[model samples]
Target: MKNFRMRVWWFLCVLPLLSACGGTEVTLGEDEDVAGMKGVVERIPAPYGAGCGIEIPVEASYLPDPGVCGNGICEDGEDMYSCMDCAVCGDGCCAGGERSWNCALDCGSVCGDHFCNGGETAATCRADCAPKLGSVLLQRVRSCRNRFPLPCNSTQTRSEFHWWDDFNVAQDKQKRTYLAQPFNPGRDGVRHLVFIIAGQQDGDMASGLTGQRDGFKDAFRDNDGSMWVGVDGQSLAYRLMAEVYRSPDDTFMGLAFDARFNYGFTPSNKQEIENAYYEWLKEKFYASNLRSIYLAGHSRGGCLAARLGRRFKQDFPQVPLILHIFDGVCHVNDHEFGTNGSGYLNPLMNMNGDWRAYSTNVGAQFPTTQNLAVYNMLSGDQVLGDFADYFVSVHAFSHASPSAVTPSFTEGDWYRQEWFTWTHNGMAHNTVSDALWHYQLSCNRFGC
Candidate 1:
């Protein structure tokens, strides 16, 4: 499919006090702007009759767009929903200034009240999503169906809930690094929590095509063709779920954690990281009124996701959960933050399974149960030849006995390993589109 992108540029608007400048001719360029915008030359009015470049806030990324759709193109539109494409809703893109908060059908769910959804009442954003209130006597009762009550299990309960956002992750980040986030928390409600973990990064390495964000938050994202890729790949899983799963009967939410939080980096740090995460995990039922969960992570995060999945599955045998390992690597970190925890990382980057069943080692130690599952996605990049010296080396899982990594459930273990051409980060940074959807379909049908 053609990767349709929307190009947004900071246009020079005529300022009120800048009438002293003359017009300057500039060339036009586009990453994915529609036709008729590629090679045009526009004259800009400058302040003081020279050249002035001052940027100002247009929209807060929330308020309604001023342009009317179906008439013409909206100014510097982001996607199909933002009313930039002028294309009507339901066409699969969120262009035309239509947002998930406004048009759930086209843009899907909004999360964290930012750009997407993650387990909150739709009515919180707009009236369309407002739960219908049925008049019962003098009071009105909200009529919502699948509100999963809390009390996750014996060890996990509602009273244990802590506002996830309040937990600052500064201890895990680099000394001066301020922009990278520790995690993005989802809302509290009866919904599915798609918890995502991002890949690893260090200062010694050069950024990839996806890691170009000012902060390391970029993820080679194919943002419904709105924002450029590598903009925010950390939250791709939840974003992809919105694109594929359109069941009005189901409500979904998501949370994304930075893999660099030193989870599983060392015995002590591993325990510390998991201690905090474990609390958050046990509180999912209380925090988001979670119904089910989908766990996905890349590189070191993948291994951690597996670890989390194992624990969650053991505790709640009746709860549904799925784990996706994107080239998982298991390593022990002993070095200081920002320095190379090189040894454990190098040997473990070759994500070989340590789990042995009858002396047969599988890809990941995680085994599937009646309700739980683990899936692995590997990059086919040759380790020594391709990414040997790259800062974030090839952490994609490769093995001689690929068939042993099957999910043992109904009808027998039928999953076969298939290698992909994406890079280590690409697995997490891609469009977060149909490929994952197809995988979910197969898993639902054939048990991971």
Candidate 2:
């Protein structure tokens, strides 16, 4: 009871700052002197409209015939020498007949490059090719555990983490969406939970760093680049992880939907993925009587979260839902402008022109792809639709919903820089989400 009183006092004290704060004054981290990182980020011309996060296969050829060995994706037992699409030239390996002349870049010297290459056997180059300490992904994951620790606050007890809709596991073992133990009701006796759907290839809420990956597909995806579980995530737990846990006892769960089924293309895969989330709503989120629910995501995941927010509100009218969108832009073929996403990532790079609007039909002078339909099918998709109790779209890549909070390029210089940095790295997303989560906390506690 004493702890509860202290929490109430803390909430009251924090509410005023949240209600009055704006981007200029919102301090995102313990230290905001990230100018060195920020300076390098701002100068790098950011790549626009990369279809959430999943990098499409080179030339959209991987999915058309994945059964065969020579198809674009390097299948099981296939390597550079065995497949035309696979290339070990830059992988620091001189296998498959690559030598000083044809592959001089790597074969110049295979003795100390950490990979036993060319004709150097394990016996000859034991030091260089010694068996690494652990699995490749494990090592990368270790290296990737950045400043972001699981952000569950010290006051809350977050449940054990086993990523759901298991994108990294065997297919038979995928799509399980329950905690090992049921969530603990807070001091308030509320089973409030936060859920986030990661953008295309972007999955793994606990993958502490950007390049941390789960599989071969991560070659293109900066897994944790959304900054969902970092700095702001640490102090404001109920936003991005069970790690997404809050001090007042609310917690969050993230669905790292690889959307691999989508690629066959990321955009085409979203239809199925979104449908799966609807099931998650029934089977997981709405598992019991929920007091309040928070929904958010980046890119395609953000678009899906907006749509899911509408569904949750409709199904449980008594429950309050808060929806936040982070630069969501979806490009699928369902609508007129929705092009086949199988090639979405490839064609954009080779385009000779800039799209006035987001479209696979690049260079179109006025392609009408910037409709709410592109993101997801939201019922409240008018000029000012109400999808949740509170809806905020920090639209930089593009708008997530056609809701009451109309998005514009004029959201201030703050919004532009946030998304721009979000494009190359997740610094901006971290800051924006940090600021917004605090504001959300204040609002949930005191109706700020």
* TM-score of model 1 (CA atoms): 0.44
lDDT of 2: 0.34
lDDT of 1 by residue, 1-448 (tens): 1222212222222111112222344455474233445654544232110111233223212211323322355455433323333445555544333445555565566544343343454435432333221211110011112223632121111222222213433322322111121122433443555556655555322222112244432321211111122333323432343333422234333233333454234455554555556555565455335456667766666666767776676666556676666655554233221112221111222543221111112323334465654555555333323344344333344333434244211222322333454655565665244336544664475432
What's model 2's lDDT at 421? 24
The residue ranges of model 1 lying beyond 4 angstroms of the native Cα positions read 1-188, 203-235, 246-257, 262-264, 286-290, 332-368, 380-394, 398-416, 442-448
The best candidate in terms of lDDT? 1
**Pairs with backbone N, CA or C atoms under 3 Å apart (clashes), candidate 2:** 54-201, 237-244, 241-244, 262-265, 262-269
Residue 391 lDDT in candidate 1:
42
lDDT of 1 at 54: 30
